[model samples]
Target: MTTIDDLPIRDDLRGQTPYGAPQLDVAVRLNTNEHAFAVPQPVIEEMRKRLDAELSDLNRYPDRDAVALRTDLAAYLGHGLGFASVWAANGSNEVQQQLLQAFGGPGRTALGFGPSYSMHPLLAAGTGTRWIGSLRDPDFGLRADAAVAEIHRHDPDLVFLCSPNNPTGTALDPAVIDAVLGAARGMVIVDEAYFEYARSGTRSAISLLPGHPRLVVTRTMSKAFGFAGGRLGYFAADPAVVDAVQLVRLPYHLSALTQAAARAAVAQSAALLATVEQIKVQRDRIVDTFRGRGVQVADSDANFVLFRTADDQKAVWQAFLDRGVLIRDVGLAGWLRVTAGTETETTAFLTAAEEIL
Candidate 1:
């Protein structure tokens, strides 16, 4: 009989490994860029109440469209970011997949700047689309001239830009984004997963969606909202673009429980905003500590700061782990990305670094 190992896998997935954030039971956990706080008690209590109300319907299928959650999300964006339209999935990762399914597939290409979000290429591979990565300049900023040239050359079906980009935490300029939009021949997806952390003056691309039919801006509750475990993310775009994403998503992708929890989380946005403020404070403190120790740090707009040292990255990571402080290695050779943790955890991390360095 033919065994599973003997079966031919898809060509695109031949050598690809699954992507994941590191898991470690260390004292100061900063590996995955998660928010440094927990969801407030008020939000949790509200979710509990809503869950109690929905307990009877647990046996039934949830709203396939998650209309209530979407309505709440739209209102949240309107108040928070001046965006009026919204579409969601179980998480932003699913939102990414939906966009890829809607705009790219076999023979088509998905273009992104390299070392942004690693998931873009993985998603493209899963969809059988050609993934093209254009490396950013040494400063970790996109070269708009080169990007435009590539857009003119490849004419990709989808292009992804991550603001306050992951790992590096660098925010792209609005003018640069507009230049790409002007040159793009197809859909442009802007991943604003760290929008709240990006204190830069750069505005969300959602504001530009009215004139650009091909633009979509995706946001997540995972970062600033302190709800990574909740797995709720939404996107704002032209209605037509939103409808396209809705078409390809599976029925009941967002559970009734998830919807209830997300609605409660939005209602308590004020508290979440406060927590984000605290994280920012901690982030600045960590950055100062790194700089004081003679480390070179990237200018960050996210909850994390990336610092480069003369020592090898993996060596630094291993050193920290050995000392019970876990930070992301990110495989950038000599650079390390450390997420802001609580006051206690941040202090522990700094002390560990001082000893290790």
Candidate 2:
């Protein structure tokens, strides 16, 4: 068989692994940070109606701009944002990739704090951009001074920040964002994919968009709306930034079915998003359970918890899997991350933890 190494490919990607999680068929799978609920019936009904309406138009390409969908997303984001300030693609990965293509490719560079979203750097490499790896503090906190110092040192063309960040489950201190905006000379991309689950009073970067044209806040329906299968991720930025991404975005990149399904989900947002609070419940339960057991745990503003393992994380992870409860290893030494599933699933994980942790 002709292997990838046998064929000519990008030298930078010769040994690279594609981003993914363990997609195993387990009894209680909580490895990916997906909402544990099925799509709400109301949202499904709305989607079915909208999709049926679009069935006749399947012969043509989707709305190249996805105008109506963008308008609905703007309303959902609501930092006084309008359709011009919003853009969507297959996922936040694609949204960030488009941004990188327009702003950070070739001679330019992109930087993200470590143990942040793993995909940021991968997306950079895919775009021929140099990836600058930075770090959060020892406690996985991104302090303003530390963040600003790193920003000054690299001066990358694009900066990626994740709020209520993945794996670690911590929200960025808004002050760090303020300082980075003051210090960085290029575009700032804040990944707020878990924004809805953020603790109360956790301000969004969206509020800071008015005077800061270079700031972009990317979000997804995947986490909060149980819309991962829907493949809808979007960002809010200055209209000029939207125009820039459009230059790199594939024409009719979003399919008609996607636009219809996602818009329907947004229309039923109130119903679809009630699950956010429910997930938060399970998240806090996980946090409390781990902490009460005297295990070190990160404070979480997202629907997952990161906690230390009693032994090698891989062994502990395997132990959990052996018990029919699968969670995330996240490549963090001595630690593991697990999504907040439904009550029964969370209980199953906790039951496994009793023996494994």
Candidate 3:
């Protein structure tokens, strides 16, 4: 039997683990931060119609630039953005990889606050970009001053900032973004995959795009739009940035069916995003439930709750699985993360947590 060790693979990827969470056959699976609700009937019907319109064109290639889909994404994002300022791909992960390809490569560097979206470093490594990591405050928050100090010290070619950060649901203060933009010499990628679930008045970095061409705010339809299966993610940036990324984007990267369905979903945004408020409710419940039990819970602005598990998070994770609930153990000691699922799922999680966490 042959293994990767026997193949001629890149030395940098010799012993790295791939990024993933368990896709288990459990009752209440809340590991990935996926929105709990299914696509509404009306939106589903719309998507069906959209996909139907593309079935006959399957033999032909899609719009090379995905211009129509980009237009719809721009409208959905609407911070005075036009299609020229937007781009889309299969998912936000692919979009980030393209950004890395365009701006980061061998000898260049990417910097991020640690315990963020784990994929950032992996994407950088695959692009041959050196990754520089800095830690967040003990409270799982990043201060503007601290963020700026690290950026000035590293001056990396790319800076990755994740809001409502994963593994710790705390949202970054806009001040940190402002400070980093002022200090960093390279591109700043803001991952807002969970922003739609954020508490009220949590500002988005999209509002900061007017004067900063180097800032990129990436988003997805996976969470709020419940279009994860459709796999659409995008970003809002200057037209020039769009031009740069296109240089590396694969030809016809987004299929016609994906483009049509996403546009249709955006056209019926009201129906597609109706579950956001309800998900936020469940998220708040998770936070309160855990904190009430005297556990340390990070204040969440995303759909997941990151709380301290008793000394051994792995055991706690297994215990939840034993109870037919699946949560995430993000390689952080004594910490586990759970997505805020439907009310029933939340109840199941809380019931098991009562016995476990």
Candidate 4:
């Protein structure tokens, strides 16, 4: 009967918890911020065809650089973004890890605004980089001036800015990104995992990558493209920045099957990505429903909403679970998060919430 204490692990990781949200068995699950829609049938058919084409090559290694996939990703991003400026891996978490591995480690630090994607700090920790939790406005928003001040104060090796931030569901103002890029001495990584679901006018930091070699905008197919199961995440940066991650990433990190499926999905982008608008609609509906009942709901640009539980947060979470709907308790004392699921799923969540409250 050996325990972790007996096995001799890294001193820093001895007591640290792994990053995860609860994956429970429930009828309506809006907990993980995953797109409620599955990949459309046409895209699935396209993938099956592409995968079948790759069967003969399974014995061989995939392209280590994933060049074709990178090319398609570049075309998909389309801000005059080219293949050389993009990088991909299993998921956005791996992309962040590779960035941290390249830029952050022993004696280095990474800073993030609090209540953002929790993984920012955890990823930094896993890479042995110090993590800094900076202050955000009471409403979980980051102002440009304050962000600049914090960057100056910490002067970290890497700064993570999560747009349409998780658990809080708010987008960072472009001004804040500008100020941080101007003031920070290290690389700035903007996590845009929910970019596709943002409001119509939400500006992406991808547009800022031209002259700023240190700025990286990471995105995922998990949310909007309904490719979470496909596990594809990528980032757009200066080609030099893209090259730096290559020095740290595992060789041939993406498999042929993944590349094939993602390429097919991108090819049929219109069909697979058609659900974004509908998800946004459901998101707005959830926000309205909660607010109509006098609950404090955060304005979300992502596919999820964060609402205040105020008192008895755990009890409320349990009540929703008991009713067969699952939501996220983001450890924010008085707040919980629910993803913007499909119309029926959204209605189930609302009805369960109404009954619970």
Taking the tens digit of each residue's C-alpha lDDT, what string does model 2 give over 60-113? 999999999999999988878899999999988899999999998889989899
Note each model's CA RMSD in angstroms. Answer: 2.1, 0.8, 0.8, 0.9
* Cα-based lDDT for every prediction: 0.84, 0.92, 0.91, 0.91
List of clashing residue pairs for candidate 4: none
The alpha-carbon deviation from the true structure for residue 112 of candidate 1, after best TM-score superposition, in angstroms, is 0.8
Q: Model 4 — which ten-residue stretch has the worst lDDT?
A: 16-25
Error of 2 at 237 (Å): 0.3
Count of clashes, each model = 0, 0, 0, 0
Residue 250 alpha-carbon offset, candidate 3, angstroms: 0.5
**Candidate maximizing lDDT:** 2
**Which model, 1 or 3, shows the larger lDDT?**
3
Cα lDDT, model 3, residue 332: 88
Better of 2 and 3 by lDDT: 2
> Which stretches of candidate 1 lie above 4 Å from their native place?
1-5, 79-84
lDDT of 2: 0.92
**Deviation (Å) of 100 in candidate 4:** 0.3
Query: How much lDDT does candidate 1 score?
Result: 0.84
